[model samples]
Structure formats: structure tokens, C-alpha cells
Target: MEKEQKKNKKPAFVAVKGIYEIMPAEFPWWDRFLEVAEGVSKFYNFERIETGIVENADLFLRSAGGEGTDVHKEMFFIKSNKDKWVLRPEATASVARAYIEYGFSRLQQPVKLFYFGPMFRHENPQAGRYREFRQFGVEIIGGENDPVFDAQAISLASRILKEIGFKDVVVEVNSIGCRVCQPAIKKKIQKYYRTNIKKVCRDCQTRIDVNPFRVFDCKREECQEVKKAAPVFLDLVCSNCQKHLKDVLEYLEELSISYELNNNLVRGLDYYDRTVFEIFVEAGSKGEKKEENASKLAVGGGGRYDYLIEMIGGRPTAGVGFSFGVERIIEIMKKKEIKIPAQKNKYKSVFFVHVGEVAKKRSLKLVEELRKNGVGVIEGLSKDSFAKQLKMADKGGAEVAVILGQREVFEESVIIKNLKTGIQETVPVEKMAEEVKRHIK
Candidate 1:
């Protein structure tokens, strides 16, 4: 029985598919990011929402457009009893579904909601792209198709990033235009690409037929050559779209926000429209001491989605939101040597070290009592040595350790060892929990 138990306890030698451990040391950084995200959301009057990861596959297939978009092509599909479910590639569709399902429209004019959690996809893990990753997203569902909400939505994301202690980040904006002009512009651009397809890369060639706008998003060197003559989507914007684009820019300027009109900033997904923007920082730029060489790293993006709610069977409603890749942000923060305080509070208490089996058994219950009284308690019940357990308590940042032994237990008392002071005192067993809490503070 002991041998089998030991074998079962063996450490795992291989990590599971697309899954990685979030070590305890790294948790403080994640907690800091979450805290900042919550603070910014609260300041903006955005409520929090948590939707399940498993969603119907068609919701994405339709929301992401049929065949060519990133979500449709790179998603992980799971087979259930009779239907196919998918890990949500992103959160906007799920947020839209939540808004429709819960009848949130009745509460307020534009229901602002924020969510931070792990979103999944099956993709080659690179620096920024991961199979399983965390996204901090916010959605504004409701209100007229106003560009003010569009500017506000993007600004909310920028504000959240700014509060997270990042500098040198630029807000890049573009108007993909509304439904009236979006397709017409894509068709016009495709006509130019149709003639230039032979000169572009193979993927760009296929993109010309299915998703004509994405052809301009090519990152290949050979494709860049063909892009010199590719028609810009903004060149064909209709009158209303042209006016909306101009107004959005005016609003941004009113906010004292600096932005560059990147006409080529088409988002990867099909759901985006009219207002599309990305936030990036140039590494090695002045005023960016915290993140050296973190230049042009795409931190977050968002746009308007007035047609998405109606596409999913809900009444026509304008929706817009942005999401931040938490892991990628953390990666950049680490490379820049940026610091987030881990242990904000001082050590509250210490471990109970046991010298014998009986002492170990009795100390477990006492440790629980300390914890119940709002005290942080550390323990090493498996350890047989008093020295090793005391060392562990010190490493746990415990200010004191409660020593339990045969004599102390029989006398209905325990010895308290102050780790920092090296002072010891025997206290009555009944007062053990209370005294430890008092002394640690």
C-alpha cells in the first residue's frame, strides 16, 4: 500500500496539452493586474460578468464570419454528447449572449460590463499567442450607434492600461466604417487585389477571395511588395462613415488623446466595424524606462459591433469592447524589469513546528484555530524535525512559531518561539490561538 501510494505521488514529468502552471511567485503580478482592471472598471461604472468557457460552436462560427477569420480557423472544438461545443476563442460573443440571456437591457441605457478570465484557442504558441490565455475585456451593450460610446470604449481600455503603470504606449485608431460602406470598400479593394494576386503570397491570394480586407494585413515581406498598390479601405468610405470617422477623431482630440490614423489597422476578427484601434508601445523610446526594447508591442484592441447583436438573433443593438492579453502584457512587463509588489502586508503569523508524531497530530487542530481567527498560519505536519519546520516557518515569512511537544501538550500549553527575536514563552493551550494572533501583529 505504501509503495503504491508513493508511486501515485510521483511528480508529473510532462505538462498537459496547452496548459501551463501559474506558480505562486507569479500570482502577485496577476493579482495586481486584476486589481487594476477592477478599479478602472469601477471608475467607469462597468459591472463585472463571468460567462462559462464552453459555448455553442455556431455562435462563434457566425459571429467570427464563416471561414477566413482567426477565430473560425484557429478555435478548439470540443465534442459533447450530441453537439459540438467550443472553448470561447474570445469573450465578446459570450458577453453578447449573456446580455441577451439575462435581459440586462432593461436595467440601464448602455449596460457596461467587464470580464477577466482565460480564453482558449488552438494555435502555435509564440510570444504573444498562446493555446490557453487570459483576456481582460469590457463591453458596452445598448445605446444608439453613437461614436461617442465608441471613443469612450477605446479610452476605457487605454485608461486601464495607463493605470497599470505602462508608459510610451500609443493609441492607434482607424475607422473600418459602417455596414453600408464596409463591404463596398472591401469589394473595391478586392478588385485591385484580383489583378495583383499573382504578385502576392499564396495566403494573400486565398485571402483575396474570402476575406479581401485581410489581404492588406499580410506580414510577409513578399506580400508587403504587393501592398504598395493595394487600395486602402478608407478611400471608399461613404458619406455617413466619413462623417463618423471625422467626429470620432474630433472626440479623441477633445479628450487630449494623441492618436495616429493607421488606415491599415483592420482587426483580425470580422465582428469589428467603423472604429478599430490598437494600443502599442515602442521599446527603447524615452519615458519608457520600465520596459526597455518593448517597442510597438500590441497590448490591446477593440471596435464597434452594431450588427453582431442582431446577427445573434437579438434586436439590433450597438456593442463595442476591447480585450487585453494578460500573459503577453506580463511577458513585456517582465522583460522591462517592471515590478509589482508581491507581499503588500507584513507577516501575520508563523508555523507550528512539531518534534514528535503526537505533537504533529495535535498541532494540526491548533493551526486550524489560528486560521479561523483571521491569522495566517503555516505548518509542516509531515516534518519530524523541529529545526527543519522552524526553517520552513521562517521561509514562509512567519513572525513566530508555536512549538508543541509532549510536556507542553500534557500541561495544556504550547511554547511560542518568536522567529525574529529568538524569544520563547509557554502559553496555556486554550490561549494558544489568541496569543499567537496578538503577538504576530
Candidate 2:
């Protein structure tokens, strides 16, 4: 009875909630997107860099701007020995930490780098939003605080989305100024909110005194109405901040990239200063209703974070970067029915087939030889029947199948059959790899 009970028990094992697996069928779309991103990075002269998935908790606490930020609250913390480490909720802080630890300052100024990896955040999952997701980002560090870099970063992001088939994309830009001008704007914002405190949400009321800039980012209906009447940062900025933004706009115009100036477009992150922008795509034809709905679908965003490196123990360095959620981009591609061609080689694929024991042994040697010669090869050597093996080769998308049977083994030769043209020829064992190549062409 006890044994029967044990046998009837159901095992409890399943994938964690909010995390997903990328199956083989969907890899083509991912590959195409990454290819375009890599090409864009190369064209812009940005080198690739990678940092650890786990980092010191204090690194984010200090560099990402204190305890009030969303990035801080969403961090997944783990204790290691006496220290606390967190799964990186974002890469900017990790990259900044790497810059300081590796002494990148001694090298050339404006070290451009890009990264493609996964980031973790403990948040409720939704469509295109996962607790663990992949990100592709680029950063320019150690440069002079030039507005040109800001425009360049935005231009690169816009170009990438365009190349990936997002036709109706727009960049919304704003400037919150630096330490020199932000205090005046903050004071004005505080005074404005204090008068209408009861009208705003509880969260916004709490955040008003702590971080007034974030009040512009509130999405609630009640708070948004209050925000519309608040003081705009553009009018309150100092002369330098004004000129910096104007120059960025001029450069963007020269590049032929479309942009919209928004006074209330403050990013949620605390490190952002001077210039901030978000990339949004239109769902359909441009109209009042469609435009209003499209603005909510922000595909990607980033801005200048000049003070971030200094906060993490590095010298005062200027930096700018942007990151896009890979899953979100893929979701858009599917919704738009964008087709991606199968990523096959320029050379035709050669499938290997064998009949009988001796040919099976020899087929292994031929596959290795073909692979070593840089030939794309596929095979079904386990099947004993020749007809079934050939069927698999056709289904596997092979252009040609190389068959080795008892007769061919005795003659010390092999038969190469072109699946497309139904042509067959026998070649010497020593010349099989070369002959296969010739037939594939």
C-alpha cells in the first residue's frame, strides 16, 4: 500500500512565474534584431563590453541616487558572507562601477561601449514586461559634457529602430538641467504642488518634497492634471542648460531625425540630468487618437547621466546611454507582422546519410571532414532505412544529401544527390568533401 501511494504521487516542478523561455522557433526573429543592433553599434564605432549579473548592493544605492528610486525598491538582494549583493536591476550602475575599477579614465576620453544581456527586476509581469528580461544598450563615458554626444546617442537609437522595421517612431526629448539650474526648478515645483496637495495622488504627495522632478513622471489621471498646470523646467533652466538643449536640437535637425520638445518628460531615474529622451512608435496612421495611444508605448529611452560615475568613486566624467527591452521590441515586430528571412548560409547545406554498419562508421569521418572544410552539413545517421533518412534530409532544408551505402563503400566512393534538381553523381572517398562542395554550388 505504501509503495502504491509513492508510485501514484505527482511531482511538483514548474518554471518560475514571470520568467519565460525563448524557444527555437522564435530565435530567428531575435537573431535578426540582434544582427541589426550589432551592425548599428559597429557603424557608430561602439565596442562591446559585459559586466557581472551580480553586484554590490551599495553600488546601486549610491550611484542610482539614494533609496527613493524604483530601481532601488525592485532590486533582488542576496546575502553573501557578511556582504549584501543584488541581482543587477539595470546595467548603467554596473558599467559605471567597472569603469572606476578598471581605471578606464587613464585611457582615451569618451570610451564607447555596448552590451547585450539579461537584467532582473522584482516587478509584476505584464504583456512585454517580465521579472527577468534581456536588454541591448550602449554607453559613452569619460567625455566632455557635449550636447553633441546626447544627440548622437538619440540618433543611433532612432536609426536602430528604423532599421528593425519600426516605421512610425518618434523621439520625445526634454532637459531637467544640472545642479546649477535644477534647484530653482525644484523650488518652483514644490510651491506649485503644495497649493494643490489634496488634488494629487498619495504617492505624488509623498514624493513632492523628496524628489519633485519625479512628480512630472506620475501617470495617474488626477496627478497628470495637476502636473499640466505646474511650472515647466525649460523656462526655469539657466542660460548654459538652455544653450545645451538648443544645440542638441540643432544637431538632431541636421541628422534629419524627428523629435518633439516636451517640458514634462522627466525620466524616472535619478542619475539623469540635462537631456532626457524616450522613443515611442505609432500603432497605425498618424491621427489625434492614434497619436495619443501611441505615446504610451515607449519602446526605449535614456539620457545623459554625467554625475553617475563620480558618485561611484570615479572622477567627474560625462556619460550618456540608451537601452531597449528585447522582448518588447520582438512583441512589436510580431504585432506588425514583420517577416524575417531565415538566417541560412550563403553556401548550400549538405546532409549526410548512411546505410549499413560500415557506411555509418565512414559517414562520421566524412561529416567531420566536411565541417573542417567550412561546409554547412546536417545528418540523420541513426536511421537504418535510406528512404526515411532522405525524407528527413529534405525536411531539414538540405540542398544536397551525401549517401554512403554498402555498394559505395565496397567501391571506395560516395553518391552525392541534389535534392532540389534530383541529380546524382559518384565521387571517390578521398574527394567526397570537395565533390559535395561542387554539387552544392
lDDT of 2: 0.85
- Kindly list the per-residue Cα lDDT of model 1 for residues 284-367, writing each as its tens digit: 433455444346688888888888988887889988888888887777676666667665664476778877777777888888
Clashing pairs in 2: none
Any idea what lDDT model 1 has?
A: 0.80
Against the unseen true structure, what C-alpha lDDT does each candidate score? 0.80, 0.85
lDDT of candidate 2 over 315-415, digit per residue (tens): 89999999988888887777676767667676567888999999998888888988888788888888888888888887878888888898999999999
Candidate 2 lDDT at 55 equals 90
Instruction: TM-score each candidate.
Output: 0.87, 0.93
The residue ranges of model 1 lying beyond 4 angstroms of the native Cα positions read 1-13, 68-70, 228-235, 254-256, 282-294, 345-347
Worst 10 residues of 1 by lDDT: 285-294
